[model samples]
Target: MGTITTFQTTRRIVMGAGAIAKLGEEVRRLGGKRVMVVTDPGLAGTGLVDKVEDLLKRERIAFARFSDVEADPSYETAVRASEKVKEFKANVILGLGGGSAQDVAKVSSILATNTGGVSTMFGIDLVPKPGLKLILIPTTAGTGSEVTPIAILSDHHEKLKKGIVSQYLFPSVALLDPELTLGLPPSITVATGMDALIHAVEAYTSVNATPMTDMLAMQAITLVHGSIRTAFANGGDIEARSKMMEGSMLAGMAFANAGVTAVHAFAYPIGAEYHIPHGVANSIMLVPVMEFNMLGNIPKFANLAGMLGENVAGLSAREAALKAVEALRQLSKDLQVPARLSAFGVKDADIPGLAQGVMKVTRLLANNPRLLRLEDAERIYRCVL
Candidate 1:
């Protein structure tokens, strides 16, 4: 048996169709009076921001809004948002929208309490103190930023995506309300759903996988497999949206504790360099990374294949693993996710640079079941390219 280590999740999660309504109560429970709501301009116009603001107002909670967060949020954007948090002297932060907003809010919380640039916190356990009272509400069924302790922010000057990993980064409360995801565009739905799948697949096959993480990852895989198509086809499908939310949350919890693997490590540089959406980058790299990692953990892949509804019964573990990769490839094709990095304008010469960047993502690379050398990372990039 693998050595069992203690696992910890700092966030208290409340999940349901209308969990967003509980935001005021949760904030008050944490003794937060002044709050900042961080989100994107698009969501701010959708009136979802107003709905949340109303909740706080009814509870007599004082708040401010920072709606400049963009997709694939940058370090500068986070720093700018942190300025608002500091100016308002906000005691609590409410992240409302997709992963971008949630990530920015988490970073702002840290910057509000800590005295340093955001870049200083990149890497493992670098933040010295716990972040402020943070409440995250994910409007998209992807990225799982609500429950995760890791946040990815782009560094435009460096042309790379940097991550901050620390137990202190987890939110004080994660409120997942599936109703908030009802109107997502089909394209966004497909990309984010696939991102959730990548998280489950990587966490399940991670070198650090524990029994607890395994259970959550496997269940998340099943939910994504069964509901992704329905959610993509009809964005208003409440039932499908609910399942995706649950799956994404579970995957986030599992990966946050067990760690992500090569897929995420490889995808980061792509997102940072090419301006690819985080979910789309993960979608493009998912199948290729799975193909590379299959040999390292055939049994896990076989189980994943079975979870995705592939007919792997009575097959050898190796064959089942191969089937799983093929199944994921087909799913991506059906969802209209680009099959290759070349499709996204990645050049042959960029492979070497990307490989170097992938090597720097040691926090994620260390969790991969298969050891990935620079050459292996380059090969994987070429395959996807």
Candidate 2:
């Protein structure tokens, strides 16, 4: 018999153009009077934050804002954010902005009820207590951190990114307002949309993928392939933004359960050691990893090619599988995503150290359909150079 699998997501998802209007009502409905909004400096004084504040005030829900989160949030940032949560005596936690803010909120929520530093709960299923009621509002249509049972923090002491995976990390609600992403700049739209694509691709090709997750991943891939360009070209188009947001959510759900593979495994170290954005790192490694993993599951790759809109008619599975890779390259080129690690200041001499770092993320590597040896990891990094 096959091994049984489990999938999870937030209890409630409120999605649409005007979903932010329910922020306060959702908190109140969940019996939370004091809410803590965790976000990053990039969003601190933006009208978006002010708009949320206004909504909370209109509903008479008292709230506190902590805007100290940074990209690839550090353990210290999470610790300090949790202190704010405790100081406010907040019964609810709201994560606003991108993945970093959401990750901080998820970790701080755990620290609110669990008795320890965030570092103590680093591994899988280590969190022992239920956290405060949590609501996540994603300003960007990427990361899907709002819906996942995972939180990633940069461990400065260790000089690598670490993840906390636990059921307790799942939020009580996810409020996805496509309107919030209207003003997103083109570069972010490209990077984040590619992030969503990677999530779906990795999940679909994961060794742990199930029939359920495959369906979700395929739908996500199709949506992203069809809508990312439109969204990138015109961020204000609600239709395009809505499709990207929905696709990103589905991809998040798929990966959160099926797990991501080597692309993410290799990307983590680049982000941690070099301060590259997670999405950009993933984008840089995407093609190389896919090429390396192609032979491991040719049929699946062929299917992916079809889903990505590559014409596979009259072609062998192996030939068609290669098209998926070319399609990805074309998409990256169209979006002007940097294709070389050198663009990010990484050198050929850095390959060995990065390969070693990739080994440390065995949790993710073990799920790759193609087993990645140390030498192969080095080669992947070099190929992107």
Candidate 3:
């Protein structure tokens, strides 16, 4: 008998050119008299945070801003944010930046009600109750943390990335405003957009993929591949920005259900050790991991060429799969994202330990199309090095 599956995403998703205007209404609709705005200093500097605060002020909603969210936020960072939420007595959380901010928001929401340390909530379905009402708005077209019921926090003590998976982690609403992404610099555009694209690519190829997840992943792959270039060249192009943002949300939904494969598994170790940005680390591993995985499922990998806008007219499945790899290579070249660990000062001696780190990411590795061994992980890192 076929296995039964379940799909989950944010209950409400609001998307448009100027959707930030709806934030006050969304907060009020969630019965929030007090709100916490979670974000980072960089986005706060962008004045988007000011605009959100203004909206909340106009609504006469009491609010507190937590703008210290760091990249790869730790469990302590999450606790501090949650403490601020409790201090402010916030009833709703407004997550208004990229993955780090949104992740902290998700964790903070749960931490407020779930009476325990963050470490206890690390595994799947561990949280016993639902989090507070949460509204996440992405300022970058990446991560898709707004839609997914998964959050990753840096375990600084262990020097590894850790995740919390629970239905309670899903936000009450996901607000996508393409206008918010217009100010992203080209380099970040490449990195975040690539991250979104990789999520879909891995989702489509994951062993646990379902027809429902594949549909979302396919649209994500098509939209991100088609529009990332245009979005990179013209950040102010609302159309490109809209598609990229939507693609990211769809990819998040796909991976939330289907899970991402070895690309992300390979990324976590380098990300934790070298402090490479998540997207950049994933980009570095994409080609090599996909090359390794395509042998197990060439037909699925082959379809990626056409989905990514490459012509695969008369080629064999294996050849078409190779085209997909070449397409990623060319895309990385065009976007100028770093494709080597060597750029980040990672070297030969680091490979074995890093490979060991990759093995422990069994959550993601279990979804990899090809079986991965410790030796295989070492080889993948060295090739990229």
Tell me how many residue pairs clash in candidate 2.
0
**Cα lDDT tens digits for candidate 3, 67-125:** 99998888899999999999999999988899999999999999999997899999899
TM-score of each: 0.97, 0.99, 0.99
- Expressed as tens digits, the lDDT of each residue in 184-258 for candidate 2 is 999999889999999999999999999999999999998888999999888888999999999999999999999
Among these predicted structures, which one has the highest lDDT? Answer: 3
In candidate 1, which residue pairs clash? none
Q: After superposition, which runs of candidate 1 have C-alpha atoms over 4 Å from their true positions? A: none
By lDDT: ranked, best first: 3, 2, 1
Greater TM-score among 1 and 3 belongs to 3
Give a tens-digit lDDT track for model 1, residues 193-264. Answer: 999988988889999999999999999999987899999998888999999999999999889888889998
lDDT (Cα, 0-100) at 22 in candidate 1: 91
Residue runs of model 2 more than 4 Å from their true location after superposition: none
Clashing pairs in 2: none
lDDT: the better of candidates 1 and 2: 2
Model 3 regions more than 4 Å off: none
